[model samples]
Target: MSHPPAPPTSPHPRRWLTSRARVGLVLAVPLLGLVNQFLGFFVLVLAIVLIWKDNPWEKAAKVVATIAATALLGAVVPDPQGKDAGGTVARADGKGTAHGRAVDAVTSASPSPSPTVKPGPRAADYRGLRLDRAREKAEAAGFGVGDHNASDDGKSIWMRSNWTVCFQKTGWTWSDTKTIDFGAVQTGAPCPEEDGGAVPWPKMPDLVWKTWKTARKEVVDLGVPADHVLADTAYVNDTLPDEGDYDDWRVCVTDPSADSDVTLDAWVTLGLTDPRNGCPKSDREDGDRPSLPDRDDDGDPDYHDPFPGDRNRDSAFPNGLPRGSDGSGGSSGDDDWDWNCPHTRWC
Candidate 1:
């Protein structure tokens, strides 16, 4: 008790850095910022504490040394830019970084840099967007799209706006990662089951035995023109008396006939026959000859043949062609061509 509290064996400032320097010790944590400006807030706070602390140079050194001993260490020097941004360099999103703060602490005489960093979208995000828009987006993200866009159905995409994205692929390595691929297809068309597949085209339907009206509708539905569909048989087809019910008649033969793939504008001709009597067995009528000989013995019957005298070339002419076009028939136009082009192709 005599010793009382003998001053707790007090040591000099050189011996013990005491509570007086505790603030420096704590501030040192942020001053050694190494990662990015990630601890930007901490750095700012450290700078602020320096304003009230004594011997800032001494405190700064202590912090640098402390950090140098830890994992966070790199080329961080005092940046005059820090002073301009109000001694704050790190962003709330952590972009300002611990390094920025450390630099500010070292020599915060200049304004801090406020760089604008906007992140881009990921590769997967490009899917489902319009093809044109997807390319624009990829470019915005710092990726260049020269001519990489292609159709999933293998159809040429002349107008990008008319299609939409369905899938994506990236480049082989990270260096070429921006070389992104987008699989697309026309807006209303379904995506192909596999890339580079062709879309199926519409085909002509079987119309034999069906009423002329039903056959006509089916042809029209297949995209054939209404005016292009004509009655196959002549006897009952000439001109209906309205009450005659021409639509009730059945089709015996078709032009581009049955099951043939056809385009929308292709002309469709249907041979008409009395439903009760049925299709003609032959050009001879009454019974088919297994081969319909030219009724005129000169060329194909004028009946439903689009190219009446051109032999088996059914689609060569839309209007009736001159008979014996090869100069075989005694005359032209309506003359018989059977002299040269004989029965062929059709049953």
Candidate 2:
């Protein structure tokens, strides 16, 4: 046995490992370079170490190097939109100068200017001018006439040329829509009539004995303006009643007698009384005897008696028909001495 130690077994495993390491290094360096330059450099150094130091830990070191290279390559590659690894846009010129980079940044950051707007039509003042002139001025200023109205109550003068503008809707200012209205009156006509030239003068309507509601409607039907008709209500107890709750009240008297003529703007006042106040005292009722106040013994009341305080004419006639009697509506006459006389003693 001592004559010759068995020839040392050839190191087949070590030789196999060295050959494998050389082949791995050759393949890894070029493959990694295709992925990333920096990753390829790092992998090259790692491959050299793997080849020179063939030890028990070599397998693990090779594995770790391969994984690290793969990860680094993935991080270094550009994105699909040509952005760098850090997500910044890459310049196509590839110039590294500071001025070039600043110019690129400014161009991207600047916003485009907005489009200019054209101006619109302007407004103008048209107060206190004649209607025709006002219309002309308005049209000249790019406006249109909207409405025409009377400034006061009167007949609406259909002729615009004969109208005087007292008020304008837009006043002195111009409007965007370029339209205006004129409250006008007929030329040479009253500028501010009581009825604003809206209604014509009408005969006073017969509202007596009509309810307040009916009276108001008659007034309106007669073309009398609502403001021209005034209402005065008296309750049964002589207390003022609410004007709003006068539907049940009766019309007692009117300011102007029925069938009287009145101006268009005249105030036709209605005197209303509660139904509980009984019939209104009027000469038309009961032959004017009950309504009249005759302090003396005359047959006629003071209003009709010619000789109101004279006993000689106390019961001679009705309403002092014989005009020659004194203030008392009485005179001696066989025909006048009727059984239906107000003064029975004289009859």
Candidate 3:
């Protein structure tokens, strides 16, 4: 008599493959000269085989097999490192993590080549557009420009972005230099219609003031030491009738100590609605000359400082000036304005 239908058995012949069989299947992929895609397929098959047994031990084994397969896939994939649209993560510290490191490598390697930043309008293109002229443009816009430095080799220029109109030096051997940016004039603004092609700051309140405050803080917090910084204002402008009513600040920095020709950091502000009250020009020291006369007679200078909060005691002149003495209802250079009032010219 024929055996009773041979006892119902598993449909898959290899459903209970031994551990060695599973390992061999995975290792055999590379040896068989199969491409990574094929190996990936095998990995899935192996996992299925191991798990089909319905044993806890088998399930654990399948998971391990899958992990091994994924590791190999990383090697074959063109860019296994996952990256964001910007090609990098927003945070720099993330690079220390495994995933972050991978993402950074992939992004840096392909790097869209930095979009070949096109050269902007040259300072010379504007003809009489020297640093002072640019400074004037910033002031007229209601912004300010702080001291800046040039590259040691003169190939690149960088400055604090605290002011609007600023310059930067760029290039390696052939050394090309160019004016990089104008201060924040307004938020979401296109190039000013009057300036022909100068980028305009957006007039939006949210973006203009908020961004300005952020940039100013960055300058104060990150600026290189003066002993390490060769500072100068290549351009300063207080009047730009064509541009909308906004202040712009610009600056440059050169790190000679590091033997680098490129400006390291720059700061600037744009679209200042109100003039920053400076240490009131001291009349106590110069009451004799009408030219020295405080225009507002508030004991403060008529011109507003691009950066208003003073930290140096020296800038505060004619000691004993009271706080809120400024005609604008703020302290003039007198109150806390001691010989140490950091804003004082002689301090």
Candidate 4:
């Protein structure tokens, strides 16, 4: 009599894992170095399969035996003595090694610093739904409004004072990383090359122009009358080169003639730039290059008091121009300061 065919073999535990699970395991192999949770899960799953295939009650014995064997082996290993103990102790006491490894990992994984983005004529680069509306809001908030630049797309607006805002657009958002005060500006370096050689970033001139316009407008609107507004168009080797960083520009609202009827005296300096370039040229005559002046004409080095204490000279002097007038409203000396008395000149 032909014996009944042996029952078909049951699927192997390893083979029983789904193709998806197998793929998952393969992909997980690389992550084992950094992620311990997945590693432990993989090992657990493997152990379960092995235990299931063993003799029914054999799993319990296997686990107990493994524990007892480990303990016995550990005890037989002998208490390391002298030189052997010294090596083990050294490893345990190596605090510096642990710290160093942590630091190395952090340094290797850290992201590089990103370049700054400046406010400009772009409407899409700014905040608020309407460009003009946003400008109005900023002006109402004591901020000077200026021209804007939008990306090739009209979903954002870049304005003066290192301000950039995004318009409502799907999947678009922004966070104000920082606020810049225009009063404490320092001369900056010129914008650096973006991709290769010479000509500064193309976007710089726009920034410089926008910032100057804002500051100028604020001063005028605030009731300070300016006789002349001169903007540098030369790209000379300057002391305060444009840094092209997003810090705000230094804002100075002063009257050269020391004769205005305003109350506030505002002076602020801040960085402003795009990751690409430095300031924009206010006077478009130079064709995008910054015209660094030979002398500081902004009343910097010469006059001790560049501007009147208050917008109105009346409040500052009370009685028609106080006596000594060496230009600093103090006693006169032999300095050529008297020659330029009352006349503001750029350093």
Candidate 5:
């Protein structure tokens, strides 16, 4: 009829987009968009139009083409730091590649607020704790501890757990190299009012009327050695007493005399007596007397008694002589016992 209907011609461009070429372009559009969004944009549009007109592609191909066209419209720039990643990339997809990278750079360049630093603790925080405990806490807090007696007693620290911290010198916070110099005392003792070199020896206190146990505590607390203090009855009742028995008896006299200065190691004697028997009139009872005739029957004997014949009269002499007597065993004074006693001592 019509001259064999002339040779059928291809609907697509003969040189590049023939039937085989169109199929290849449709499949390649997604890859092209991934490489360069600008290039992908045109190819994606062309692929969609070819698919719709010639009906050469399946429904899946058409779907792919639409998605590629919308997605490749702009470029995407991912944030390297992750701080602005979601917002930056999402914004870039809507804008173009040049605009996307510009926004990404600004987002990454913004300076983060400088991080603040925290300081460490001070040594004074550990004051009043046991030396061992304080040292542990201080070391954990990045500090070192050095300790000595706050009473200034010249004693070496052999046991840290037995001592308590009184004061500290290091004041800085969180110092790795700082050593906290601590003034310390024994666990049971109170801290000194002020730092001292050596605890001053307390004077001998009058223990009269105080129990043996009470007397021991007073001197012992004042830095006296417990063994140096002793208790005895001087045969007042010929009754030997034990520690528990001491609680029953009361102290009547002290050896060094009350108010005398004594050291920590000084030996002290307590004269015990039954409260019912009452203390003897003897000025002393620790066997220091001469043991001569006690004419007045007072504790003093004639050998060195101030006045052997008359207890009421002051001996006329000081060098062991009685009132105008010859070879009297009295030592009250020897005509002139020595000026040290008559003028300067008890009248």
Candidate 6:
């Protein structure tokens, strides 16, 4: 019976733990002293001496001397900026090459700044170009042919090299004394009323009795220039005819005369004639032949003498009626005669 009492002598050789191993050694020693800080502070002082065995060893040695004086006062202080264990930051001349420049000056990482651009203004596109190359590309882009505005759908604005642009003003951000406009058209002239439908100009017709190769093909179909249609010979009598035959000549005098209006390609002249001298009369003809002199005693000549100075009134000679100077049917100064045929037909 005294042997069974021997089992009660147990002061602490490690065996009586269970209350769930004293709450699993008081939560596994501060989670194993946050993983390995010296093997979790030597397994947190051996699990606080087996979870304070039966307590009082002077309150379990003052709870393991207050967790070893708070892990020896956080390992004797010192981290001003000397961080280590790979959190880098060491140098105050404690060279590891100033610990990579003190971890490139405190665990490194700064680079941000960048942004600045500017440059606009300078234009000259000139649409279909050619008003003298759109004024040489708007005066070589520095603008100023008094800036610009050309505009000329015909009526010859100095025929700007026979024109072309068609309409311009384009995008324009311009500024070297800005100004633009452009419009143009004539090279074969037309498009202008805001570029839609214009082509009219040609008119100048009646090239007189025609033929200097039909008046130079009607003045080169009005765009003018069968050498600006000049011609000039016109001699009904002199006889100088060795070889001049432009279809035997004919356009008798036309310096803008026949139905006049003018201007398209301008410069006319003509005067040809010599159709063996037949049609050249025009000082506005039609008096029916009376180069003057027949005061009308009725020979029917003062331009067919209607009552030319009335020789007893032949009234244009009705079937043989000329009896003047008192031959009986009535004559002698026929009641004081004074007719003067067709307004004194060049009397």
TM values, all candidates: 0.33, 0.27, 0.20, 0.17, 0.37, 0.23
Give per-model CA RMSD: 19.6, 19.3, 26.3, 26.0, 21.1, 24.4
- Model 2 poorest 10 in a row by lDDT: 98-107
Which 10-residue window in model 4 sums to the lowest lDDT?
Answer: 180-189
The true-versus-predicted C-alpha distance at residue 230 of model 3, in Å, is 38
Off by over 4 Å in 6: 1-132, 139-163, 171-193, 210-223, 226-249, 252-347
lDDT (10s digit) by residue, model 6, range 1-347? 45544455665545434435654655554555555456556655665665566544467665665576346534543343424534344455644354433243343444445564333334556656568878777777765542222333334457566667766553334333554556676565544455444545556677667677777777777667666767765542222234445565777667777665455557887766556454545665664422224575444434335666766555434433434433344436545322432222334
Model 3 Cα lDDT, one tens digit per residue, 20-109? 565666565444324566655566565546544554355676677667655655455454344443343433455554333223334335
The sequence of per-residue lDDT tens digits that candidate 5 reaches over residues 120-172 is 33445667899999988878776766788788667777899998887777744
Give per-residue CA lDDT, model 2, range 24-72, as digits (tens): 6646675777777777777767765665475444677657755664564
lDDT string for model 4 (145-200, tens) is: 44423222122333334432332221212453322112111112121232112322
What is candidate 6's local distance difference test score?
0.54
Give candidate 5 misplaced runs (Cα > 4 Å): 1-121, 171-176, 197-204, 209-231, 241-248, 255-269, 275-347
- The better-scoring model by lDDT among 5 and 6 is 5
The best candidate in terms of TM-score = 5
Count of clashing pairs, candidate 1: 28
* lDDT of each residue in 311-337, candidate 1, tens digit only: 534433333334335544444546455
TM-score of 2: 0.27
lDDT order, best first, reads: 5, 2, 1, 6, 3, 4
Residue 9 lDDT in candidate 2: 79
The TM-score-based order of candidates, best leading, equals 5, 1, 2, 6, 3, 4
